[model samples]
Structure formats: C-alpha cells, structure tokens
Target chain A: MSRPKRQLMMGNQACVQGALRAGLRFYAGYPITPSTEVTEGCARELPKTGGRFLQMEDEIGAISAVVGASVAGVKAMTATSGPGYSLMVENIGYAYMIEAPCVIVNVQRGGPSTGLPTKTSQSDTMQTRWGPHGDYTAIAVAPSTVADTVTETIRAFNLAERFRTPVTILLDEVIGHMQEMISLPEPGEYQVVDRVKPTCPPEEYEPYGSTDNFVNPMPAYGDGYRWYATGLTHDAMGFPTNRPDEIVVNLDKLRRKIEDFRDEICKVRADWMDDAEFALVSYGSVSRTALLATKLAREAGVKVGCLQLQTVWPFPLAQLRELLQDCTAVIVAELNMGQIVREVERVAPPQARVHSLLRYDGEILTPIQFLEKIEEVRS
Target chain B: MTTTAESVAEQRRSDVHLSYLRPHKKFPNLWCPGCGNGIVMSSLVRAIDKLGLPRDEVALVSGIGCSSRMPVYLDFQALHTTHGRALAFATGVKFARPDLKVIVITGDGDALSIGGNHLIHACRRNIDITTILINNYIYGMTGGQVSPTTPSGAYATTTPFGNTEKHFEPCDLAKGAGATFVARTTVYHTPQMDRVLADAIAHHGFSFVEVLSNCHTYFGRLNRLGSATALLQMFKEKTTSVGKTEESANGKIPIGVLHRDLETTELCDEYQKIVDSLSKGKQG
Candidate 1:
C-alpha cells in the first residue's frame, strides 16, 4: 500500500514536527484536553532528537520551566489548554518582562473553567491579549489548517527569538485534532531562529543593557555572561525594584519594543476585499466557516470578503482599519462571546457598522451560523 | 582532596562574580537586616568559585522569598521565576543544558508551600542540579507568614495565636522523595555550610540542602529571638549530628547530612540514553 504515502499528519502532530524543526530542545507541560496531543507528540518525538520532555505537575511549572530553559540558552516550549493557559499568565508576563524567548501553544478549549475537554472554543482570544497581570506586549498567531500549524509554529519560535519574548501559537481544538495531508520539507527548508547572543567579553557584558535597543543580546547561562533576571519591575541590570520611574521605563520599553515594530510582526490574510461592500472577520478554525459563508454570500449575489487573521495580537488594527474602509458592514465571527468583535468594532469606522456572531457553547461555528449572522446584520 | 570552609570562604571573597552578575549590587534585595540570606548567598558564591565553574555556564533559578533574591546579587545567568516553581524551572534549565551548572535557590515558604509538588518531583527524578533551600522557618518577604518549617507551636503573622500544624524536616522529606544527596546546615555554621553547599553542587544527581536561616525581623520576633546573634546561638544549640543512630534521632532531630547515596539515575542522562538507543535502532 506504499505506507499510505507517508505525508498525512494531524495538526497536533504537525506542531511537534514544526517544533523539532525550530530546534526546540526542551518541553515542560501539563496534559489537558485538546492540548494533550501536543505533549504526547513531543514525548514520542523528543527522544529521537536528544531533546528533553517533562510532564510538569501544573501549567505554572510548565511555562516556568520553559522560561528557565530559554535563559539557560535552549529553545524551549510548553503546551496547554484553557485553564492551563490561564494559570500560565503570570509567568508569561515574566517571560515578556525579562525578554526571555520561548513559545507557548495554547490549543484552546471551552472556557471560564473546566468547560469542555474535547470541544473547541475561541474564548481565549482576549485573554491571550491581557491574561497576564501587569502590562506587556504579546505576539499571538492563530492557524486555520494543519499545514498552517506547521508554518505558524515555526514563525512563532522565530518571532519569539527575534523579539526576545514569549510568542503564542493559538490553536483551537478543531484544528488541533484535524487530520490533513501535509508535505514537510527536510530541516534545511525552514529558517530557524535562535536569539542573538552577546559577542562582548563576559566581564564587559551587561545582561539587560544593550547599546542599540531595549533588549540586550542574551548569553546562554553557560556562555559566560552571568546576568541577573527577575519578574519584578527591574532596572537594566535585572534586579527587582519598585521605583516608579524605573518601572515606567522598564514597562514602557517592554511594550514599545514590540509595538513600535508591529508592521513587521503583525500578519493578516485578506481575501477579495478591495471592492467588496461586506466583509467577514475571523481567525483560527472559525475563519474556515467565514470563507464558506463568504462563498455562499457571493452566490446569493452579495459582494462579501473574508479577513483571516494569522497574527491576532498587536490586533492588526491598521490593516483591519484599512480593510474595513470600503465595506458597508463587517461580520466578526468567532467561537467566543464577542471577544475579537470588540476589537473589530474598535477599529472599524463608525459609519461602517460591525456586528458579532459569537458562541460560548463547546461547539464549532458552522457556515450556516456565519451566514445567518451575516444576513441578520445586513438586514 | 581536603578543603575547609574557612579556606573556601576566603577564596570566594576574592573570586570574581559569575558572568551574570553586573558591576553594582542589584538594588532592593528583599532580605531584612541581620537576615541569614546573605550568608547563604555567600556560601553559594563560594561554591561556584571553588568549583571553578565558568560564570556564563552557571544558571541560578530562584522562586519568590527573601533568599530567592540571591540570584539578583551574584552575577550569573538567572531566572527569578514565580513563587514555588524554582525547582521545576531549574529542572528544565539543567536538562536542556546538562553541561551547565544549574542551581535553584528557594526560601522555605516559597519551596515548601506552593512549590511543594515541584520540589518532590525534582528530587524523585534525580535531575542533575543542586537545590539550595533556605529554611528561615517563616515567610520573610510576605511578612512573617507561617511556613512549612514553622515549629508546631511557633507564632507567625498568619498564625498569630501560634501554629497548630506539624512542621516538615526538609532533609528527611527530600531523602524520602528520592534525592541522591540530602543535607542540612545553618548559616551560623559557616564551615559546615560551605562544605555541604560545595558537596551538594558537586553531586552528580539531584542534591538538596536545607539551610536554616534566621529571619530575625519577622520569624525571630515571633519566636522570641529578636537579634541575629540570638538566632545563630539558637541554631548552634538546636542542631545535632545526623551520624547519630535512629535511637538518637528519635527525640532529637539530627541536622547534618541526613542522607547521601548514589543510585546514579539522572533525568537528563536517562533521557539522552534513550535518544541514543532510539537513534541506534533507527540506524539499524
């Protein structure tokens, strides 16, 4: 039977392959629904690559360990579901505040608390933006297909390394478990990114101070530049302090470093939007439904387009405002109760009405749901 | 092969900070005055110095507490992480780079209360790292809350009327959790503290040190030892040799190297071995 052609894999499995391709050497995570496959996939594959895999006792431990591995100079990652992601917020902030590069894959499930293990939900979209306490910037990507999981996972790591912050590859359980045919090129095809390292002598290195940017090139723990790191609002030297001016400077730098370069980091896919009167805004698995609805709307003699978000954070506000310019109205469809719809409403022109089609029940949004919401909003 | 604590201390004082430590002292160290956290920090720096570990190769992971501030003072790569998860982070750090020396510095409240799960598992897995737990008998940073090591009748901010809970002997707990090397020492005993700290760092597998530190400002005030000198004297009188048999440990808790044995199973070593075997099998 030729071994079934050797290329078909599940989205979770694709994530593991992508992580390996990205040179992820350590994974510490707790198994939760939908996201369990990620840990299982890593457990099955990490042994072949001489990488380390550990089932941490909880989500906090999982992300904390990933941050630690990054500081020690290894590409590291952790995976989790809704509750687990919520538990990981503080440490995620720590990673951003300290400029520790790592990746987190949140295979999102139904929310508030242990809502549903096997089902899918996009409830975490806003949580991903503001989950962690205190203020910082985040780069979050949502993938629609199993293939996109592979590509976005690689990009997630690249963004993390390039910015020296934690990056999230937001996947819904629907995509996480979806089986599809994907051809993964050999390791050389992907451009893997490792964080830039300091070339200065160990004695001359300032762990948090860089001459060119807010981020200092991080030296691996064993590379000889001993630098202090802390979760507290810190000075450039990595020491904890509550000084108001120092906190303002540190916090502003963390937010500005990523926000200033939003044009380079933010990504969105616009389909047939230039002359359309109506637009559908969505991401992750729901974007698939939006595409189907857009096709149906076109057949019904309605000129509609779809904006599929690849990078969900930094909100892609500029692109979104530009996209919504010509549209008479926009329908924002998601699995949650109006999370991204609020952002759409925030960016869309007042004259261009924006409406939401949201679901909190543990079920995928169907094409019919999107069509119904579009018709209701159009009327 | 012979070394004394005094020799180690002198050498450490002159030794340069690890590559991670910057020129000036990191500001706002959370430790209170006359606190023994400084002693523990010095002991660690001394161990790093004596071992001749390249500064950049040593990573110090710490959780929240007074002693958790150790990483900020000494130069070296550090991840001052959340409360109670330092060991878990150190596990990832050590396993990811087995070539580097990974040290976890945690306080009693931080390691034993919220971080309890990580502590036992790290010991059970025998990961190649050293965990230095500073047991000040109370939560120093959060205002003298009763900790896992608070004596049964001792008073604390959280336990104002006096605690009703039983305390854990961290060394015994670590040994029970399968730590390959477990020892107990006090900041007052500088020579023994230095020696035990060095040995713990040198051990191949997971090594745990329960350092009895004095939080004179909080824990001391509650326990009636208001001064640092008084707490040091108390430590001297209370601690006994672990070499004593079970009969001796029956009434008096032995406080030296309570457990030391090597089954020689390290987490990263076993993981790497599995990788090797799998690769070999694939080749065949």
Candidate 2:
C-alpha cells in the first residue's frame, strides 16, 4: 500500500537484501574478499529473522553446509570469490546430482588461482558453468548494476526453487563493492518462490519420481518424507543406482528441467540497434560499458547497438543469435580474456564477424575501449 | 505395502534390527562377509532402536568408506555424501532442523584424513550431532592403503615395507578438538558400543565415538592378522574398560566413555537463544 524505501547500498549488501526478501532461512559461507560483505550481511540479518547463519572453517564446508541445509528444507545460500568457488566445485556437482535447490554467489576476482583479490575481472566466466564435473546444466544470473543485483538474486533463488537446481549469481569485484541507490521492491512487486513440497503422503511419495516437466516436488528432512539423498547417481526412490538405464534417467532430468524451459530461465537486456551495423555483446559490469559505448557510438553516427546478458550460463545462444541477426560486426567486450566472446563467435550469423574486446589486468572495461574495438572491427 | 502384519512380526522377532532398515533398500549390506563394519553397523541400529527415535525424525549421514555404507541400508532420512565431508553436511542438517536427530557414520580415512578439517570444526562447535568414527587402520574401500590410524610399523598396500608415520588415536583427536562427549570401543565389545552410542545420541552436544573395527580382508591380509576371530581376540586382549584397577594396569586401550562435559552450551541451542533474544528485544 505504501511506496518502498530507496537507499544507497553496495551490490553485495543488495544481494543480502534480495536473499532475505526471497525468504532465505539458512546461509553458510567463509570470508573472501569482494564477497565478505555478503557473508557479514547474512550473519547480521539471518538471526534477526530467526534464520541460521554459519561461518564454516573453509569453502568446502561452507558449500557442504548449504546443501545440507537445503535438504533439511530451508532456503539456503553461500557466497565466495574465485578461490573459495574453486573449493566449492565438487559439492556444486554433488548438489546437481542430488537435485538440491540452492543459490551460490561468486563475486568473482581475477584468477587462474587467486590472481587478484581486490580488483575486478570476469576470468571465472567459464568456470561458473564447467567447474563442476560431469553431465549437468547450470543457471547463472549476471547483474550489471547494484539495483539489478537485488532483483537478479531474487530471480536466482526463484530459478533454483523453480527447477529444483542450484543457480549461480555471478558478479565481479567492481559491482560487488560498488555502491548505488536502490529502490527496494515492495511485497508483490517481485515474486518470491518457496521450495516445492510433495502433495503425496510420505509413504507414496517418490522423491525423484518422473514428471512431464522433469521436476519432482522436494520434501525437507524431518517432514515425515524420510527421503534419501545421495551424491551417487540415484534411482527414482533417491537410492544410489549404477544401472545404465537408471543413470541415464537421473542425468537426463537435470539437463531437461532447465533446457526444456530455457525460455523462462534466460534474461537479457538489449538496446539501440533497430537498424545498426555493429553490436556489443557483454554481461556483468561490462554491459554498463557496452551501454555507454552504444550511446556514444550513436551520437558519433557509428550505427552500433549493445546486447547485455543478464543470464550467462546455458549460453543463451538462441536468444543471442536472434538478437544479432541484423548485424554485420559484433564486439564481445568483457573484463576476462575472451571467455564469453567464444560463445558469441559460435552464434554470430554466418555472414557476421565477431570481434573481442578483452581486459585481464584486474580493471574495468572502459566505454572508450569498447568503442575503439567496435570501430576497428567495423573498418 | 505388500508386507503383511504377520510377516512384519516374524521379521521383528527374528532380527529386531532389520525392522529399522529400509524395506526397499538393498540390504544384507555391501560389507565383506567377515568385515567388522557389519558388527559396528548393527550396534548402531540397536542403539537407535533402543533410543526409540522416530524413523522420519532421524537423518543418517555418511561419507565414502566401508563404514559410510551404513546409511544406505537404514530407513531414516539418509544422506550418502562425498568422501570425508559427512560431518560438514550433518552440521548443516542438525543446525537447520534441530528437532531432527542427526548422526554421522565415517571411517578412519574418511573422518580423520580427508575430512579432518570438518571433523575438528564440528567438535569445536559442539553441535548436537553424534559422529561414529570406525577405525580399521587402513583404507578398506580403496583396497588396504595405509591410513592415518595405521601404526608406524604396520603393513598396508602402500606401506609394503611398513607404515612410517605415527598413528592417530581418534578419541584423543576428538577430545583435543573440544568434543563435548568422547568415547572409544571396538566391534569385539558390541554391548559397550551399543551402550556408548545410545548415550552419545542422548548427549546434548557434539558426541564423538571411535569404533576400532577390523579390516580382515585388507589390513589383516596385508599385515598377518589371520582371521576375523583372531582380530576380535586381539581387541579383547588389547583393550580394557576405563578406571578398572587390574585391567587399567594392563596397558590396554581404554574402552568406555572417556570424557563428557555437560555444562557447555550446544551450537544449535545457543543459536536459538540468540534468535529468541532478538525477537524479544524487538517486542520490548
């Protein structure tokens, strides 16, 4: 009934705000630079809402705790930087295999291994999808601004709960620490999805029962479901199975649950190229650079547009291919050394040429930088 | 649903522990025929059966090992997790759902080696979860590799010449890590293990029970320990109950509840108090 409050908050702070808004009841994480604020925020806020927060000894424990908490029927989350994210890949794979819904926020820093802690880099772009081993798909949401971080985080939880899979909120150091004014959404402004519980009685309930959509309702521990969860490939009853037929069924559900409905899962922000000749494709804070560059290109009569990716994983190639259909030249600008550019090259129309604007010095990509790359590739 | 009431009664009378096991799960278990892990698992089942905890209200969590396989056969809300990380997961389960009883089954390598960090931290927090560390002195599942509990001069697949590192006593490690309740027993002492486990579950804080089980197939074959019976005899001769005059003087392993501190607040309860106080503060 009343207008929502507007306040200046860091991107990490907004993430905590968004997680709490989405009914996060459990958080477990270890401290990492550029993402420590997220852990601190949850620690201070979770107990206030009667939710539990824990600072596990290390990243493995942090990720493990989140999966454990999620199984016990709480909306759970964890945040970390590149090093911690590396420690979490194994359990992220575990979470995928068991089909536990949770959110992981990687406020990415420069890295092969801890390249730069305080500086910004999107080097972990590919790691977000492929870090966890085996056959599975991941849903990732990338927010370019502080305010967008809040909504994207809520969406991350929603996607995780919707498909019953772990979703990643990928941010770089620039956005994670950057402060901006965010008008917090009132209740009913943005939808919050709670975990899906089985309607069937505890006895008849099959935790991994097949459905047309490939998603089965999840029941929390101690709710009389007495369901089993294992990292091993499991059958319909949630017990481990090594049979070829059963393993295929277990692996297929993970891929199809998100892939079959990617139209609902992927989000992108595209602008300024109704009849443009050149385009800039980017995500995270680089999209902010791409937006400014497109505006500058338009004023300079350079006929360039920008496509900002809000969701990076599952590639969003189909949507991107459609967006770039009219363009002759595309510049994929990012802080990493051409991570997302590789994906753009695959989707660029056969007649179109995809150019890369890369930065790996742990710094932001500037508008002038993206514009220069566009002009060079155009000529 | 097909199980008849008369058949259920027959099963309960024949083997009470089988009634607690999952009807659909592959049972008789995957442990080797003469494995000490089987005895250890049955003791756990008996302990839970005696405690009268509801099946739906208890969660069995385990890491990868011969001992970790215990959860697969249980009727409880079971979680078969990665190698060496069951305690970390169990901490989350218990912390999030404090009303549910959480138990962790791990082995020497799973708990003390790969998962050592989680084990120590779980003890330090004193969360209301019970951990059963089944020490077989070698990595049985991985085919008898030397483990943290393997003696300095013991033989294993990797330690063909003999193990060179000093062995770890699991109970000592638990106590050092600030576990609120610590106990040690062997498969040979089934009654003591059953009693110790039930008490450990009843304890209001983190309870660590070290179970010295024999890996007759691996550790025994590699070293010259003979049959499962010989290993059981060795346990009887090697261990004595805590605080017995003549037995204590025999320089044997102490088999009993070694340490218990009831005064310290558990992790979940303290966290609840914080949550309660905050809500009260808001109201006032």
Candidate 3:
C-alpha cells in the first residue's frame, strides 16, 4: 500500500472521517457545545462526497431522522452533547425496538440537564447503558485519542450493522476537541460491515426473521421487499403482536443477539500487567492520564499497569476478571463520580480490592492526581 | 340491462380494491363506523392510484393518532413512527432517497401541539414531501382531549367547562411557514379531497393538505353535534369554495387550493446543487 497520508485533525473531525469511511451517507444533528464540530465537519465534507447533512430543529428530531435514514438503507449518524443526548434517548430506544442500524455519538458534557456545555466529563457512562427505559442491551465504545476516535467510530457503525441495532460512541469534551497529528488509514486497512440484505424473494421476505447468526437481514424502503416497521413489539413477520409467547421470543432475540456474540463484540487494551500488584482501569480521556501515571510509577520502582476499555458496554467483565487475577488491587479512574468503578467492583476477582479515583469538577484527571490516588488506594 | 359504462365502473372499483389494499389484514379498519378518517384514507389511496405511482415507490409515514393508523391497511412501504414525529422521519426518508414519493399522515394534535416545531420546520424547509393533516378538532385517539384546532367554547373531555383557547388555522400556518403548496377540503367533499390530495402530491416541493374531518364518537358527542351524519351535513353546508371569490353569509370557512408557489426551489434539490458544486470544486 502507498504511504498513509498524515493530517492534523481534531477528535470530532476524525469521527466524521471514520463515518465517511464506514459508508455514512446521511447525518442529521442539532448543534450542541463540545460536539458541534462533528456536525460542522459533516456539513462541509458529507456534501462533497454526495452525502447529505441536516441540522434538525432539536436533538429528538436529529435522532429520529437518523433512524429514518437508516431504515431507508443509508448508513447514517448524529452527534450531540449531554443536553441533546437527553432529548435523543426516546428515539434511541425507538431505534433499538425497530432494530435499525445507526450510530449515535454522544460527546458527553457534565450534567443532569445542560451542565458544563463547554467542559468535558464522562458522566454519561451509565446513561449510555440504561438511558432508555426497558430491558435491553446496549453497545457503547470510548476513544482515548483522536486516531482512536476514527477507528472506534468505524467499529461503532460496524457493530450497529452486525447486531442490527443502534450503537453509541461515548466521547468526552477533551477527546472531542483535542487536536492530534495522525496518519489516516490506507484503504482496506480497516473492515467495514454493511447490513445484510435479504436473499429471499419479495413474497417470502420477513424483515424480522432470524438468520443463522440471529441477526435479521434488513430491507430498505422502496426495495421490492417492502415491509412495515414500527416501535411496537413485533413478530417475525415485522407486524405488531401482543401474543405472550411472541413477546417473549421477540424480546429474548433482541437481548441474545448482542449477548450471544459478546466475545466478538467486547474489546479492551491491557498494558504492562505482567508483574504488577496494582492496576489502573480507565477509559475515554481519563485513560491517557492512567497511561502516564503507570509510566511514572513504573520508572520509580512501583509495579503499576493500565487497562483501557475501548468498548464500554457488554462491560468486558470476563476480560477484566482475567486481567485482575494476579493483581491485589485495581484503581478505577474516570472523569465522573465513580460510574465505571462500580462495574469494576462488580467484576474484579474476590482477591483484588477495587477502589475509585474520580474527578468531576469539569476538569480532566491529571497524571499527578492519578499517581497520588494510586498511592492512596494502594496504601 | 347493464351498460358498458356501468361495467367499466365496476371494473375500476375492483381494480382499486385489489391494487391498493392489504386483503389479509382484517376487513373494515379499527375506526368507528362513521369516522371521517376512513373517508380520508380512501381519498389518499385514490389520489395515489390516480397518480399511477408504483406501491413500492410510495412510502407512507404517520405518527400516533387516528389518522396515523391509515398506513397499516394500505399496501405500501409504511412507517408507524413515534407520536408527533412523522414529519421528521419522512424528512430523513426523502433526503436519503429522493426517488421515493414520501407522504405524511398526521392529526391536529399530532401536528400542531406536541409536534408543532417539526411541522413548521418541515414547511419552512420546503422538502419534497406531501403532508395530509386530518383536523377532527379533537384528540379522538386519546379520548377527546382539547386540541390546538379545537374551536373556542367547544366541550371536550379535558375541557369540561369548554375550551378557552383560540383555534389554529392549519392552512394559514403552513402558508406562513413557507410551504410551496397549501390546500384545505373536508371528508364530506370526497371528489374535492381526492383532487386536492393529488395536487399536493404532484407539487414539486413541500405541500400541506388540511382535511376537515369529523370524530362524532368523541368531538361530536361531547359537543352535541347530533350524529356522524349530521356532522357530515354540517361540513357540507358550512364549507364554501375559495373559487367562489365571495364570502359566505353563514360564516363558513373557505375550502380549496389556498396557496401555491411553483417558483421556489425544493430543499432536497437545493442540497443536491450544493453537493454538485462542492464536488466540482474538489475536482477542479
């Protein structure tokens, strides 16, 4: 392959490049702080590629339009911050129920409502998992660097299409706005997954019927295989059903589609854990601090390692359990008040004590602060 | 004693039945016997049939209301979306695939109350989609609540003491919001409803058609508008055609094509121009 072209890119711009590479042809978003650059980049680049970008009236409309475009057989996406993400939760649930393949990028800002629009926080960690009401599984990924933003976004869209559901890319303001120099991936360096289309004739097509892999092939509108799509609980034929047996079967399929493939869906990166007594578990922008803290501690004759979670949901519990087996303790670091730490506490081995290092003052956790917390947690 | 013309009429009726409707789904829709929603649905189907578009090429989208359920019985690519958000979804569909003929079916409350922002923006954008707003003057699906188009002093379940708010004129709202085409007709005016719907569909930009329908089971019973038949009679008597160019002495509202602007560029087409220009700049 020819030499990869190098470019200085913001994290949000990297996300747009990744989406374009993943076949994103439509974007509908309402501008919000710390996340507006993603929309702006899409507005400038998507049209140049013959793709469409729309600034919706509100975040709800943004997500609703994204779902609609996905149903119409276009790879689509939207970006927003905390306040807009709150408005998008309803349609996010709708996309899940209808099994539409789409991606939602939440560059999280602090708050219950419109808090710290310009600052970064990882407060949406839990909300990304259970924001929409009901018993359903979610797939979310976090990127620690501008380059990872591009790769993770491509992975986000791939996972959405693979599972036939909406995927969330959980970003924080730091990663979304921070500038970094990186080389764009050469063509064919990364794999792109498209939604599987039906091979059966129109008369025999069932939009919701399970395939061998449990994911149903999606047929877009205006295709010869026209079908009804709704947020209602539906049967194999894609028609609404209230039958008790059908409801169980339908809901169970939605859960199992992601859970059954957890091995392939979950991802994490472990560094320098070969001979450590303690480790730092981190994700998103906080992982950068954790990495630097580990390096400083290791040089000073302290045995410390870092585990960065790239895929936040499906929790990567088994991987965490295995990685923490030899360690005596694990420090969970994040920008929020002990969100993912709770998950670490739940999944860490019984012999490993779990502690949290949280910083939620609209400031990123620094390496010095993390090193200090490591000493305190170890003591 | 059957003539050739009668035979031809019979054949046309059968052709419409076999061509447009889903036969397997239970006969007679879930609407009430005298509900004007059925009349509106028939008019829509007839309009599409008259346009001669393939069923696969037409996608009908609707929100949560009595009128929104019209898509379920028709054989088209249909999406029954969330309450008050059908226009937003249809906008996405049209933008993604401008080749498809997109149509939205909504009601007064669904379009003017909870979904008011989307409705006005849709008109303002002038996207190439046809919106049919069914104005029954009450929220029939949710059991006779006061709607934005509910006339002042009207008795609704929520407005037990009579509604105190002024009613909305949907056609005026659409026209004010820059809709390329706007029209109004009633269920009682069957031929006029069909013609207006067809014209709205044929219009190359955003088009809004407000159908003044009746909900005798809710709105009429609460306000004592007699029976469904009496409500239909009232519509027939109270609606004056805009083509007449004279005001009705009985204070009837005008019904007919109220606004049309063929010169303004449609939104999707304008976006395509941007795409083309950007591509040219990149290549150059």
Candidate 4:
C-alpha cells in the first residue's frame, strides 16, 4: 500500500507544490501570460495551506506588496513573465540592498517590451543580472524540467532565506506551461533553509554586522530588537554613510560573500563529456533538447555532450572551464538571441570555438534543431 | 497590552533622542528648521519605545524623499528604498516575518506620486501594518516639487505658475481605499499624533496617518507661509477634528480618526485561517 506515486503536473503547478513544501506563506503577484499559471496555482493552493495570495494592481505593486509581506516575517513569493519582471526591477533592488528574503519567479518570454507575450525567450538572462541600477549581486536559479522547477523553486526559497537576499527562479514559457509527468518527492526529502534569526539581545545586535560567517542574523518585527536597514551605503549599524573606503569595502563584501562561497552557490549537470569533441552549453528548457540532441549525436558517432546549468548566475565559469577544456568547440542553445553564449565564449578556453543556436520567435528548439547546431559547430 | 491615551501622551515627551538622533550634529539637514519630519521621527521612536516592540523585530521602511530619510536616523531595521514604494518594501518585510512590526515612513511625493498604486492596494488588501505618510504638500527631497497633496493654487518647482491640478485628500483617500484605521495630525499636534500612531499600530489592519508637515523651504515660500512655525500655525488654524458621527465637509477634514472601520478582514489572518482549516481537514 504505497501512497500515490508520482503524478503528472504542469511546470507551474509543480512550482506551486514547491512553494507549499518550502513553507511559502505569502504570495503577491500580477498575472501575465506564461507566468499566470503559477499565480493561478498559488491562488488555489495558498488559501488551502493557510498561505496568503494577492493579485496586486500591477507588477510593481505585486512585488512591493510581497516586500511588505516579507518584512512581517513570513515566507513570501511572487511570479511574473518578462514584462512584469521589468516593472519589478526597482523593488528587486530594494530587496537586494535591504537583505529581505523572498522568491520571485520569472517565466521568461520574448521581450524588449512585450515582443511576444505568449512566446518563450531567455532574453531576461542578462536582464535578471543587470535590470536594476546600483552595485549589487543577485542569486538566480534556472530549472530544466518540471521536476527541476519544483525542486529549484524550493531551492530558490531556501537560498533567499539563508542569504537574506532576493532569489529568482529563471523559467521560460516552454517549461512554465509545459505539462509533464514528475514524481513529487516526500516533504522531508529536500533541505529547507530558514533565514537566520537573532539570538542576541536587541541592544547588542547590529542589523548588518558581519561575524565570521559574513551573514548577519535577522530579527523579525515585534520581537523587540530594533535595527536599521537602508539601500544607501551604510556601516555595520545600518546607518547611511558617505565614506568612500567604507562604500568600497561594503560593496566588495557584498560581492565576495557570494563568490567566496561559490562552491555552495553554483550547480551544473554534465552528461557524456569524457571523450566529446563538441559540447552543447544550455539551460532551462533548452537543456532538454540539448540532452536529446547529444544522445542522437552520440548515436551518430559525433561524440557530443551536454552541460546543463541549474544555477545560471555566478555562471559556473570554473566548472565550465574544466568541462570544456578538452572539447573542440561549444554550441550554446537557448530560446533567445544568444545571451549566455557570450558568457560561454568569454569563459571557454581560447582554443575552443564557441557558437550560438538562438530561437527568438517564442518557440522551443527541437532535438533536430539542437543537433544541427552541434554538428555544424563540430565541423 | 493595549496602550492608554495617557501613556501615549507621556510617550511623546519621553526622551527618544538617544535611540534615534546622531551622536554628533550632522550638517545639511534636508527639512526646514522645525519641520515636522523630525517631530514625526521622534513620535515614531517614542511609540516604538512605549510599545516595547523588540528593536530587532521592527523594520522601518521608507521610499525616497525627505521623510523617507527617517529610516536613516532610526536605530531599528530600516530600508530606504526607491521613490513611491515604501508600502511595497514594508509589505515584503511584514509578509516575510509576520512577527516583525513593520512601519513605513513615506512622504506625499513618495507615497501618492510614484507609490500611489502600492499605497491604495496595500490599504485595500488590509494587511496588518502601519504607514506614516508625511504630507508636506510638496516634494521636499527634490527641492519642493509639486505633490499630489499640493493645493490647486499652490506653487512648486514643477508648478511655478501655481498648481491647477487637483490635490488628493489623504485621509479621505485612505478611508475610501478601505484602510481600517485612518488619521491625520500635524507635528505641532504631537500628543494626538503619537496616540493615533500607537492606535494605528495596534489596529490589526492597514493603518494610515497623514502627518500634515511643513515644507517651509518649498511649499511654504510659494504659499506665503514663510517659516516652519508659520506652517505649523497654518495647520492648527485649518484643521478641526469632527467627532465620530459628524460628516466631514469640504475644507474641514478632521484631524483625528477620520475613520476606524474594523470590519475589513486582514489578508494574512484570513490566509492563516484557511491554512488552519486545511491542516485540520488533512488531520480529520
């Protein structure tokens, strides 16, 4: 008498299940195509879980409301597509500087301002990194499958809480709306990280003080500790300052905190790269086609492999360097105008050639299309 | 504990300077001398002190502007965010922890201008939080530009020829937007402001306060109220609190508890109740 085995679910539904499992008690969002399903699923499920769901007036309000909810000390999230993601940049910057822990899901769509609302694109890859002004680092995870969507959403929540930073689940339209069979892991199977709580007396705790761990403990409101947080350059006490050296040191620390612990932050999957002449570098739904293309290429004796990225930002360059060092060339396949391909070219060895296979009209690349690029790059 | 009216008054006069004020005087204070933001900041600190909310459990959020800088001077967890979105950040802060007492100190420019949508929806949704909007009738941070509250005839940087645009009566706006607790007070009216703020904090729903402040440098110079004291005098002269049953007339906006409709449901509580029922369903 086994409990119900794995069930078929849409990528958005899986994300909702992930939010529930991760203890996401609040969700604020505006509905847009491709990403609307995530909001719809949350709307139906959050109330059942005693979790809150709000359809804000617009994307800015949605993210803002989530930020407000976050400070009140609940696990909160919001979902949107590319255009909505653009509107959320200001609040995202606020979350970054204030060290507010929350999750945002962007079901990527073709954009430069609503290029194709219903189409898929990875154009937001660079936007997610540089959309907001000012100096800050972001943590974004790209999921390749419906199972990955669920797990990665949970991981995004955990990473956001642990780091006291906003984390983005970089999904595309193809994966977000795709219906797929996935086994839901038991509730206890995955590690769920909660934000660090203040253990010291309110008088002694500085909101941004760095101990050996480089992360400060956060105290939720009404707990009696009074601390200050601001977007401006501040000292350990969270008061604004104009010191140049202090600004430099604080900015450096913000970057180093993530990079210093890169091993814990980065994630990538490799398949059949031991004796490969060509490698297909891909992420999100595009990684699926690359994997299938690799299987076909290998069967055709082309010796191709796939490097699937899970943590897209802080782009696992070191792992990439080691993985592609011996390969003759790397073909990057994505649903956008070759964003990550540039990153691959930048990080790949000087001797290894880099090529991009882009699809911008809101369509997913099929195995044939990916194999064509791999074969062309190999020749 | 419920706070008493007497204690609220005592809180206002209480020495809150040590907790918030910079140890040494910093120059180039943006507010006009004797402007209400300092008083409002003091009132906020005193209210937090009176309630004895754990400092760490409190996160003060503000958007860009003169009043938004209130977070910078406070000792509590604060986020000085972008223009017009303090409510949004405070929303994030509150939803993330729910245990945290989140306070948003925003201004007319930050709240009603760029942040107007966030403000309206936050009130409508009725989340349990407090928003202190300092209404100085002009954008003080950006050299006293016209704001949503600037009187139609008022002059501002953007309205050099006198504003012909309509002004938003904040108290009415909050009440109409379904805020559970809405109040208005001038900084000169310190006792009432402190008491009302504390009540707003304890109200269990979205609480909004329009602290009619003086923008002597901007709104004042244009409107012929030349000094901060003169502006305070004007606030005293213009405002009169209508008791609970009285209908507020045009040009007679009340100075206290404009509306206190407790019937509106709080979003998180409703959400939690649903979770409780579901978990019970699972157990049964």
The model with the greatest DockQ is 2
Error of 3 at A24 (Å): 1.0
Interface RMSD (Å), each candidate?
1.4, 0.8, 1.0, 3.4
The local lDDT score (0 to 100) that residue B186 gets in candidate 2 is 94
Model 1 ranges with Cα > 4 A deviation: A1-6, A187-189, A210-213, B1-22, B26-30, B245-250
The local distance difference test score of each candidate is 0.85, 0.91, 0.91, 0.82
Candidate 2: regions farther than 4 A off = A1-3, B1-15, B245-248
Worst 10 residues of 3 chain A by lDDT: A205-214
Query: Which residue ranges in model 3 land beyond 4 Å of their true spot?
Result: B1-8
| Alpha-carbon RMSD, candidate 3 | 1.6
The sequence of per-residue lDDT tens digits that candidate 3 reaches over residues B163-238 is 9999999999999999999999999999999899999999999999999999999999999998899999999999
Residue A228 displacement in candidate 1 (angstroms): 0.8
Ranking of models by TM-score: 3, 2, 1, 4
| C-alpha root-mean-square deviation, each candidate | 3.4, 3.0, 1.6, 4.2
- Mind giving the per-residue lDDT tens digits that candidate 1 earns over A289-327? 888888898889889999999999979999999888888
Interface Cα RMSD of candidate 2: 0.8
Q: Where is the poorest 10-residue window by lDDT in model 4 chain B?
A: B19-28
lDDT rank, highest first? Answer: 3, 2, 1, 4
